[model samples]
Target: MFHKEGHKIIIITFLLVVAVALGAEYLIPIPWLQVCIQIPALILLILILQFFRNPKRHTPHNDDHIIAPVDGKVVVIEEVYEKEYFKDKRIQVSIFMSPVNVHVTRYPLGGEVVYSKYHPGKYLVAWHPKSSEDNERTTVVVKNKVWGEVLYKQIAGAMARRIVNYAKPGAQATQGADSGFIKFGSRVDLLLPLNTKIKVNLHQQVKGGIDVIAEK
Candidate 1:
């Protein structure tokens, strides 16, 4: 299935591809030239379609388990001081998303959104050490009786131009539900309690709403 955020772009891309194919079919004198033009046009449309594809995920709901919020590889797992909200030492787990990875952000666990804020900043590479703080991002904290507050940040990568966030303070968040989308590529940082047990390792590939990244 396609994501709602991609509907407009998908339609525009489909029309553009059709126009390009038609122009090549009739205007190009050589078959090889037409093939070259049409093939790339189709490929462009395919890439856009694939980028926004939102496959349904059946999230195994467990309040104690914190699942991966996006489809990507685990790039960072370390204890760091999160200054924006908690302002204390926490285990920060960061997942880096490439151009081809699913860009939909999901709630790691069900809870009430205690804090949600957007920051407009530089578009550094997602993996850069300072990207989480220097790049365009959004910080959201979900609080529940079982897990307390779990904070996650969506950091925009160099290729990303927009970060869509659906989280609002005081709103209810469902575990594994779509929380937002980051166009092109980015990364997500999950800041948990210092004693939280991380289940994933560096370079490990994970799926949004599917893979557990940590637990109490």
Candidate 2:
């Protein structure tokens, strides 16, 4: 199924492609040139439709486990100092999303949102060492009964220009539920307790709301 967030853009693109194809058929006398123009336009619409597809996922409900927030490859798993809400050392797990991967972001666990903020910055590569802090991103913190506080940030990559967030402080978040969406490619960074057990390794492919990335 297609994502609701892309309905408007997808419809507009579909209409534009139809208009262009009809215009070329009637206005252009050369049949060969009309086929060339219409072919590329059709391909463009197909690619856009594929990018916004939202497959049905069963979100595992476990307070001790942390689900992956986006479909991508595990890029980094390291301990770093978190300066935003925690201001302490924490384990960070980063997933890098390509243009072909789903751009939807989901909650890692069920909890109450403690912090939600947006930061506008440069559009660096998703895997850059400083991209988590330097790139346009949104920080969200959820506090659960099993895990005190878990922080996740959605960072925009060079190709991703828009980041949509639905998290708000004091709101309840459901595990594996849609939290936001990023246009194009991007990365997601999760900051957990320093001793949290990580289940995935670097370069491992993960699916949003389906793959368990870590545990308490």
Candidate 3:
């Protein structure tokens, strides 16, 4: 069976290698190379383990309404002016993905991709006020019959340098379907029409592709 959560194995392997390397250094300390080489190894191990430890909740069925696109704490939920594409009033829900959380991005609603674009920019902190505009990100607009046009952004944060988005214009995407994955820490911004009802609140912990973030 394919390990849906295979990151855990990578963490375990990292820890084991670090332990062995530390043991080897202590057992055979050389002249100037006597310094411990395990510090960096330990630090890397900690980071990798933390990333895999975050909750890996299952993505809900496609029939469900708007599910969350990333696992993280809901940081923003208010009417915001979306400038890049919509350039209009939208209810923006921002989820802050820590280094420990899953970096995958999922479709929030079922629809055909009407527009998709990638912006190359700086890697600001995910929550930085200008990160959404300044940071490297992918904007995807999906047109749905029930919800009209819904926009989702895959934003690359300081630690996350790569953002993988598979959505292409004219492609059909279903709610809760795996749309892409981000490496390391990041954030996801969902831009919905102001009239959409928010089902979650700021600071609420959410599971990507599982927890409903809003409804029509």
* Per-residue lDDT of model 3, residues 1-216, tens digit only: 212354655757676876767776777667345345655566677666566553445665554278899889999988899887889999999999998787768888888999999999999999997888999999999887788888999999998877878899999997777788777789999999888889998899999878898876
Q: Give lDDT per model, in order.
A: 0.95, 0.95, 0.81
* TM-scores, all models, native as reference: 0.98, 0.97, 0.81
For model 2 the local lDDT of residue 25 reads 98
CA error at residue 177 for candidate 3, angstroms: 1.9
What residue pairs are clashing in model 3? none
Q: Given candidate 3, what's the lDDT at residue 75?
A: 94
Instruction: Report how far off residue 97 is in candidate 2 (Å).
Output: 0.9
The runs of at least 3 residues in candidate 3 whose Cα sits more than 4 Å from the true structure, single-residue gaps closed, are 1-23, 30-36, 39-43, 49-58, 62-64
Which regions of candidate 1 fall more than 4 Å away from where they truly are?
A: none
lDDT of 2 at 196: 94
Q: Please give the range of 10 consecutive residues that has the lowest summed lDDT in model 1.
A: 192-201
TM-score for model 3?
A: 0.81
lDDT of 3: 0.81
- The positional error of residue 179 in candidate 2, measured at the CA in angstroms, is 0.3
User: Listing every candidate in turn, what is its Cα RMSD in Å to the true structure after a full C-alpha superposition?
Assistant: 0.7, 1.0, 4.1
Candidate 2 deviant stretches above 4 angstroms: none
